[model samples]
Target: MTIVRATFLDTPTGETAMGAELRAATDAALRVVDGTIVERGAWADLGGRHTDDDVLDLRDGLVLPGLVDTHVHYPQVRVTGALGMPLLEWLDAVALPEEARLASPDYARAVAREFIGGLAGAGTTTALVFGSHFATAVDALFDEAQRVGLRVTAGLVVGDRGLPEALLTTPERAYAESIALARRWHQSAGAGSSPRTRYAVTPRFSYGATDALLESCQAVLKDVPGSWFTSHVNESQAEIAAVARLFPDATDYVDTYDRHGLVGASSVLAHNVHPTDRELRLLAGQGATVAHCPTSNAALGSGLFPLRAHVDHGVHVALGSDVGAGTGFSLFKEGLQAYFVQQLLGEAGLPLGPADLLHLATRSGALALGLDDEVGDLSVGKAFDALWLRPAETSPLALALRHADSASEALARTFALAGPADVAGVWVAGEPVKS
Candidate 1:
């Protein structure tokens, strides 16, 4: 058992409603047994109560819940700055060519190291990663994620058309490979009930995946009891048009997936930047989550996210780095970018606060990936997945943090200036992965 004393900040409870407030504990302590937080209170009070337990003092800077990334590609970690092109063009010219190279296990292993290192280094303890087309590459990703103890949900990227031939797989192959991978990593022994890693049924997007492939994807979900489903939806006008052309009978892009029974409580669709009200209502009614990749939207010339509309429609939304198309692995950058995009939207925006940004980065993501009960916050019964933001003494972020008048201001500065370099420590389930 260990007692962690820190100046903690988080959005501990509630939905991502407007005017959400931070749960700040300037001199707080958490009693951790194994990996779960058993108790929490003021440092002076909790410390006196747990006198014999080991103590981890982190009062020098702010400690926040471990960041959660709902949508990021394991294969695109090497193509981060392949800029200057729109979505389809960039995927064809830059991203797909690099992803195809993962067919080599050794190369996939190397990329896995860099990708996992990037996530851990950036204080991201939980992520819903988009995996590679090759089963070997996905295995490499899961192996590295397990080795590092990051909470990951990923699977093979299956698509039949529109991508390179090497990346394509028939519906039969997709089902077989997906179930096999899930059984190994997600359902090993009786671990399926509470596995550290989980599987996600990832179809690249509607444009690339055919009806047969989607039906097979639904079959994979039915076979793997606790598996998740993720894919792209209405990201750009061109993509939406293409999806419409492909699925002429469907009502909209969301319908293409919905018709196959793919959208649900466990589904996390990325980049619904241009979702219609009908789609939003459908998603909300079905209890699905949308990963709003703000940076990726701006970078790919995808339109501003309809955050206000989604909120009004009762849809759940979370943040994603969408790395490569996005800047990097920092949720702070994503949060700041989310704020910027909202500002650009003017009255159409949600006008987020520091608490809103923090919520989106942590709890909202946990909710999206269906891990809220275990890892979203520092409440009793939740795991000790957290990060310490102790910037270098001489750094500007450190200076700004010191002079901040309130916890809210400190958190605002954190989103504005802090990055991976300022993350001094990271813990997942009470075990230190970085320090």
Candidate 2:
């Protein structure tokens, strides 16, 4: 058994529902048995109770829940900051071309290593990754995640139309290949118990699929019990127009997926930046999550996300790096970006507190992925997925945490200034990762 004492912070339930309240332990201690968190409480009590256990002290640093990134692209990791172009044009010029490179099994394996390394290095313990087009490449990604012991939900980016010729998959082929990949890795490399990996049905977006293709994806979801579904939604005007053009009979863009049975409790749609009121209501009622990608939205010149609008409607919200277009994999950057976006929106934005920002980076994402019962907060029953943060000694965040009068002030300062490099240690399911 091991014991770690630090200044710990988490929001047990979502911050929005908890009145933006923070659950803090100024001098917190955690007890781990095997790979599970056996106890978490005030350091004074747990430290005295577990006097014989090996101890790790984080005197000045903060212990935060391991971050969960609900949306990111595996193949586009190298294409970040292909600037000055909007969404569709960037996909045509930069994104798709880089994704096409993953057709090589050898190249895919190499990219998978960098991708998995990037996640852990940035303190991301759980993620919903966008997988490569090729089954061999997707396999490499799952293999790398298993080897790293990272929790991931990912799948092939399937579509049959309105994409580069090299990336297209026929409906029959899409189903067969996706099911085959699921069979191989869906149960944490098919290990049969509490596996860290799960499969998702990821149709690239509505514009890329016909009814035939999307129906096939729906079939995969039905075939795999406890599986997930995800795809892009109203991220850009041009893309939304394209979707409308393709699905003329549908009530709206969200309805396009609803028609195909892809919008539900198990589904996560990326970038609802342009969802109409009707769409928001539908999403909330259906229990789907929005993988909010603020950096990607801003970088690609997509409009500001009406985050408050979704929250007010009771929709589930989570963070996504949406890398390549999103800039990087650091959930800190994503969290900070969220703050900046809200600030830009002014009063129209959600009145997000420090605890809410941390919740977005950690718990909200887990809840969105339907893994809340297993990971997310420092609650005793959850796995010990956490990070030890040591900001630059003289940096604003570090100095503020040193002098702040209370936990709330320290947390606010850390969110305002800390980055991934500040993460001194990362643990997932009680084991250290990120080298």
lDDT of each: 0.93, 0.88
lDDT of 1: 0.93
> How displaced is residue 384 in candidate 2, in Å?
0.2
Clashes of each: 0, 0
Model 2 segments more than 4 A misplaced = 15-18, 188-194
Number of residue pairs clashing in candidate 2, backbone atoms closer than 3 angstroms, sequence gap of 3 or more or interchain = 0
Indicate the worst ten consecutive residues by lDDT in candidate 2.
13-22
Q: Across residues 125-183, which tens digit of lDDT does each residue of candidate 1 receive?
A: 99999999999999999999888889999999999999999999999999999988887
TM-score (C-alpha) between model 2 and the true structure: 0.97
All-Cα superposition RMSD per candidate: 1.2, 1.6
lDDT of 2 by residue, 82-155 (tens): 88889999999999999989999999999999999889988999999999889999989998998888998999
Best-fitting candidate, scored by lDDT: 1
